[model samples]
Target chain A: MADHEIVIAGFGGQGLLFAGKVLAYAGLLEGRELSWLPSYGPEMRGGTANCNVILSDTPVGSPIVQHPNVLVVMNAPSLDKYEPLVAPGGKIFVDSTLVTRKVERTDVDVFYVPATQMAADRGMHDLANMVLLGTVLRETGCVGEETIDEALRHVIPARKAHLFDANKAAIEAGKGYVSAA
Target chain B: MKEKVLMKGNEAIAEAAILAGCRHYFGYPITPQTEVAAYMAKKMPKIGGTFLQAESEIAAINMVYGVASTGKPSMTSSSSPGISLKCEGISYLAGADLPALIVDVQRGGPGLGGIQPSQSDYFLATRGPGHGDFHVLVFAPASVQEMADLTGRALHLAWKYRMPAMLLADGTMGQMMEPVELPEEHEAFGTDNPWAAVGTGMKRPHNIINSLELSPERLEEKNVERFERYAEIEKNECAWEEYRMEDAEICIVSYGITARISRNAIVAARAEGIKVGMIRPITLWPFPAEPLLAAADKVDSFLCVELNMGQMKDDLELAIRCRKPVDLCYRVGGMIPTSDEVLDHIRALAEGGR
Candidate 1:
């Protein structure tokens, strides 16, 4: 692809920004131009949060992805806000457990994943973001699995290095979830 | 140490300042630009430097004035309202000929505007951020990497010219994240100037630094000398970038975040054979008037995009002497104009649909 714009949105504690950062880093590792912009608002913590991630062979013009080719929404509010903005023939990954309403656009491809439920089943309650990331990787092929793995190694802070293996497992399980479906 | 890493624009600017040998940082907390101070607070002490959270923006700017008078690189940053509070100190710094760096990561406002990205401070920065007929070298960075790069350049130019410099950025540039290569670390600028206020100790007379000259004639003389230096800077330091201008019929003029969006619109317009180009001013103070004047001879018309009510458009009109029709496309407050919206305007202008 010449360029790919993605927006990941959810509540504040959902790691939406982190997922975007990881993807941006992966694009950097692949030597593509990339930008990651996080939403800044008054109510940060329990408030709605979103981030725009752009990957391009050419330099990215605006970091704000007004119309994204791919949107990953983890909550109902995010789905409501971003669903109408998805480009035609775009791909949307909706976390079915949190976002109950089906996507309304027929021109775009919508994939429903039980990210929260899958994380719960795997006993990793807060890994839904990673699951969605893996599903995005499988659907979009925007970043290689090796790049995502390498990016994860660098992105996980040294203080939280112990969680790297578990996060890797979550990613694999997420990709497996899609293949099985 | 990794040379490239994902970094926020605000944090990148702080890291770049540290690398540029700016050991003294004084700032107050404000929205959209608090990260610059937070980064300095966390890292300055670890690097054996000073980071003071002053009581107010005015105090922070005065602290910068003191540190810079000693010939060491020092800086303070704020949002639009807080920067307004620092105007007096900025004028004092200019009057005393002390070099310092001031960053204004702008938000919307004539008064405590929203903490969203805005380029409304263009006139304030380029036309004289402070009073007393002085000009601060203003650099408008369009990207996160340029935020880091220009912070270093801004202080360097300030030190070279013995004048205050300002990095004109916005909330988007400060909050966004991208890969940046941090500058190599350097020692703090040496405090060994003949004009420094350091105690003489019977070694050549004492050097006194003060902005109060009292005499109208003396102040006028000082202003004349300062304007001379500014003229030299206007001749030498103006920087800009031209994109797709070789065969362009219409040229778009912009800077900062608006320039980033214009680049996308120009690219899209090109694919549709609209023949659009861009001129992005990097140095807002030493505004690149000459190239723009030359481009007026080539392009049919000019479209100026800004995040404010067409402030920079006046600068473009003044530059090209109103020889070409200069159209304005802008949005006020903190709303960013979308690329598609800009493209629509460009398409209209191209097809004579305007």
Candidate 2:
């Protein structure tokens, strides 16, 4: 099987790194080789945050993905920065509510999900990241949805356990958007 | 007892050290490596272990000296600049024939350079961490799992050889997350070595744990004994990994995070019909010279990749005895070389561009 190199980018508070962690956990739950590398610095809060997630059948090298096969941009800046870097035939998932600009790349499949607006509509304000993640999973089928559900249990700290249901709803809404598209 | 959990490399090192029976941890906070000290700080108190954030790196290493003298496993963690400050203490540990673990979660630097990931301290780690006729066993863990596994192994080696051992990692590994199968925890603060300074009483003579020897002859003897132990370690403890090397013409030599990058580069090179492979040195102190030399015999050329200005390139040349052309592809300070850049180098060498 071909390896999956994914780049998740957004503002720090958008749970970009947490989304990557959930994806990586899903891969691990399936007993696949995976790595998660986050852009770590003092500006981790309200700053540009990004992470690379590689899920492969073989050993992964260089957890820093330069030209990711899959890119999830949760904000305008993330979309502007990473859209061009996605591989020619790669897939990109954008949060359309915040990123009003259209994707310019015609070579790749682009899914414009209003992740934040949809999450807020469902009264799950903090799960925009999971909505985008669900859309990516639906498009790529990198890991099963059940695996992601199982992964959520691990990534969400016990103190935040109450958010699991809303997070799951956001993910389902995302998949629903993709199917509707 | 095989259970896997997602963990950061720095935290894994702390957990591994605890599992290896280490009870004393002394360290000052440094970026890229602070998690190590933090993990110990949180867990040690509950386990009845000692975790003291020393005033400085020098004090931390000396605390290691004091604990190691008791023959109980002790550790100290730091980054590049902090490790530099602990050099005097390291040399003292070496001269005193003490066993302890020192972890350098390396960051960019000659002096307070950057907190970003870097392997620029290769010379300090493998060549000379301190002044003197001495060497510390250096283990370069390429993954979070290895970060944990190697720390445990390093503690065992330090105790067995009565020498200081180092886990030479970088900021990337420390920060990255991966699934790791943790080892079972051992009883903390336990040591059976007869030389411990616990107490002599009527059973044996008092044990002296001092590095200072006034007489030249006595110091020379001590140095010779340490060198002999080093030779034995060289024979028995050199560790390395070979990937897709059976039919390759070019060999890429790397360690730690750079090795991880090379693995991807090699796969890309193979996809492009470039017959390239890699040899990752797991143990940097023993240097994996034998395996490197063996690879040198089969491969046409060798390319050494690192996050430094080509420190391991020299070791590659020395190991191969300058038999083949050994070239270098490197990034200095905190920048990481992309897989494409490394593959470009491999492609150039494959096409005889040299």
Candidate 3:
């Protein structure tokens, strides 16, 4: 809880950046200093995109996170691209559905969650990122569990706001994936 | 202070401007930057500020020019192509030495490029945004907070210098949401313009705010007098932030969204055991040359990463003196530079000594 830097990366369609934004928003609710920056461009059409979120007890110096205490890989290329650079002891939550390849780094704890399959099984196909969020919550407890669900509710645009229950179920299921592991 | 609000970049800039005591808002709707107008539309009426959505970007800026002539405080915003439309108006404002704030939440463009984040307008914004030996005080915000903060400062400086000020932001900085703490409404102190068109009380000579001068020597004198303000802006208004550069061997130069991306790159590069830091220019026009030039002397190599081919890098070479290699790595045509991509360039600088 001192100061956490986290990067959530996945394909452009995935809510990797949204998830990062929610974390930053939740941090704001906690009155913690924070910044969230997302990558943009045509690469978003098919390739990987990520968001950098930094939560600090002090005034956050640079909004750009250089080395993250946590890395959340929601797709294969995300893990493929960022795994090698994670700081020692930094944790990673890898989505098994998108990331078929096992992680090579053994220095840090790696949680393999089939968040996509779990969300699909739970009747919410697009809640994998939330599931990953839940896994992140269980592993680090960076933000309060109760606030996260509320953060998700408040952060999503109103048009998609009604998907709350399924998303909540997906996150709980995501935690279960890691808990059962 | 008003409540801490979760606001998009454009909304933040508009509300921030109001907090800075700006009473006139003129703009046309442009993608990414439209939220500025929407927010102003909703709040300006409530707060007794004037909000005018003009027929076009040209009309909007000229309206800004007219309001600025009254010398209270006024602003206009547009995207890249739309900003191009405002350049002529900006030139006139500069020539008249009028104090005004202009925000460009730049989208991709040479001509209606794309409705995505882009720093391609770096040249258009920094290198005399309009025409005829004119300059703008261009402030670039790396995060939404800086966007809010600089918007207020832009207003204050515009009034103080009697010059045009621009917030040179891009789409990512416009659409992204962040929490902002708005200052007290009346904290923004207003300036008095004795020459304002606002009722000369029928006592003083009628004030004429004009960019035109009939005599050749008179116009040249006017241009020279205006440049004296530009020199003051350079000396007094240049701002930037440097991170971990005390011993940085490899450095990256960036601004706005590219600045944020470079931060991630610096960290990723550090994990790869490379010593790297990012220097972000908060003011695009003044360009923050001193810090960059000092780093140029310190770091073995510098990489200027942007969403464009290499515009900001051109400035770094000019300002930083390029004692070491100042290379440019970029993506374009509505594409953004990734941290990994930037790290690739940083890594090259580390290993190959570029």
Candidate 4:
């Protein structure tokens, strides 16, 4: 990756932190330079949250990014908070069912996947972040499919080992949504 | 020592302290430095060490006092405001002349300052923390590796000086990631600390670790004796590093995390054909006055940049004691002054010509 910057945002319970950690771990697996900084002030205790994921083939500068190349907005607040900060010709993946507000910008590509409805169809409400991750991997080709699978294997600790099948199914459902879009 | 691990400053200190035979750690959670307590919480049980999350900073340092009185390597850590609460116990520790390692990974503060790294506690660390004329051996480490190195050194110095020792760091130093090499493990793990309150065990006289004595004259003797030890420490334990000062006309002096920022400024100033260098004092208590005095004789001027309103600059002027006053460059409240900002001050000072 030359410069792959990701912004994942949502309310506190939406697994935004876990999704960002997986991306950072994927960068670690690829042996690339990366930084994972979370919105730690008011966004910490069950409030709206966001994390910045930056991966580079070389050393990264300051970890904070004012303009991210890709955004995965999980809620309306996140969409409203981060929509305009997307770079020109960047991608915005919004949960169509949750994020009702549409982007006004014409230069960037926006995809409304109704990801929560898709997860509900698959009976995996908690796997929304995984679905979004799969769509991001497929659409942006940010990381190879094989590398992401390997990264997911280590992201969840051994104590939660039994949830693997659900996570994989979530990824497949998200991949299917990307293809449909 | 074997593998080169990229570690945060907090985790490096926790691991190094364990290797240095410190098995008991008590701390309360504070930002930027909480990782130190968390890392110990995770690993201490596996290594048979004790990690306690105290209810308050006051309780935490007193818990440290309890453990340190037993004479095993024991420690506690906190940030600026939390450290202020622990000052009473630290004063008691000093009055009793007990050896313990207290780490202040300082955050910006007069009260609840932002959690962005700061070197604001220079005066609190170097001068006596609480009431009375007691001094702690304060060590300032500039890098993550130095965090590990100086933790081990701080433990050793606490034992040597028979007083409380502190590793004073800033939030940036606590939160940053860097590569570090741990010192090789040796046979000192089981050695008995001479002052530990490990009870005489029915073989020798019973020990009491207390700061209070009924008589005032004896307390005065303790005061004079501690000062004598301070004199000895000043003689033997002063540490400083000088960079590119051979032909430097302006010296940029900083320590803790600010020194790293100034190191960058020093390089840029030199690239712009300015004769600016940096003098970093590794130990803040001794204050490295001799080196500054010597530098004053060599250089045309000196600039001290700190995270507080001229805390360390106060010491620099006292140390140099020159006809010309030292220039102060400072930032407060968790803000990091960039290299360009510091270099601008150096340029302006050079142009101002004393």
Clashing pairs in 4: B69-B197, B70-B197, B71-B196, B117-B172
Model 3 misses residue B212 by how many Å? 1.5
- Output the better candidate (2/4) by lDDT: 2
DockQ winner, 3 or 4 = 3
Given candidate 1, what's the lDDT at residue B48? 100
Candidate 3 clashing pairs, residues 3+ apart or interchain: A66-B267
Specify the highest-DockQ model's number.
Answer: 1
lDDT string for model 1 (A1-181, tens) is 7578999999988888888988999998898889998888664587888999999888788888989999999989989899899888999999898988888889998888899998899898889999998888888899888899889988889999899887888787777775322
Assign candidate 1 its CAPRI class. Answer: medium
> For each prediction, how big is the interface RMSD?
1.0, 1.0, 4.2, 4.9
Each model's fraction of native contacts: 0.67, 0.69, 0.17, 0.00
Local lDDT at B156 for model 2: 89
Model 3 CA lDDT for position A40 = 62
Query: TM-score: which candidate is best?
Result: 1
Write one digit per residue (lDDT tens) for candidate 3, span B1-354: 555766778888998899888879999988878889999999999988899989999999999999888887889999898999999999999888888999998887788788888888899888877778988889999878888999988888877888898999988788776678865565343566786888867788898999998899999888888778678878988888888787799878888888877887787788877889878888888888888888877788888888887988888998877577788988887677667788888887788874
Question: By TM-score, highest first, what's the ranking?
Answer: 1, 2, 3, 4
CA deviation > 4 Å runs, candidate 3: A1-22, A36-142, A149-181, B1-5, B186-189, B271-275, B352-354
Lowest-lDDT window of 10 residues in candidate 2 chain B? B183-192
Whole-model lDDT values for every prediction: 0.90, 0.90, 0.83, 0.82
Each prediction's TM-score against the native? Answer: 0.96, 0.96, 0.79, 0.75
User: What's the true lDDT of residue B341 in model 3?
Assistant: 84
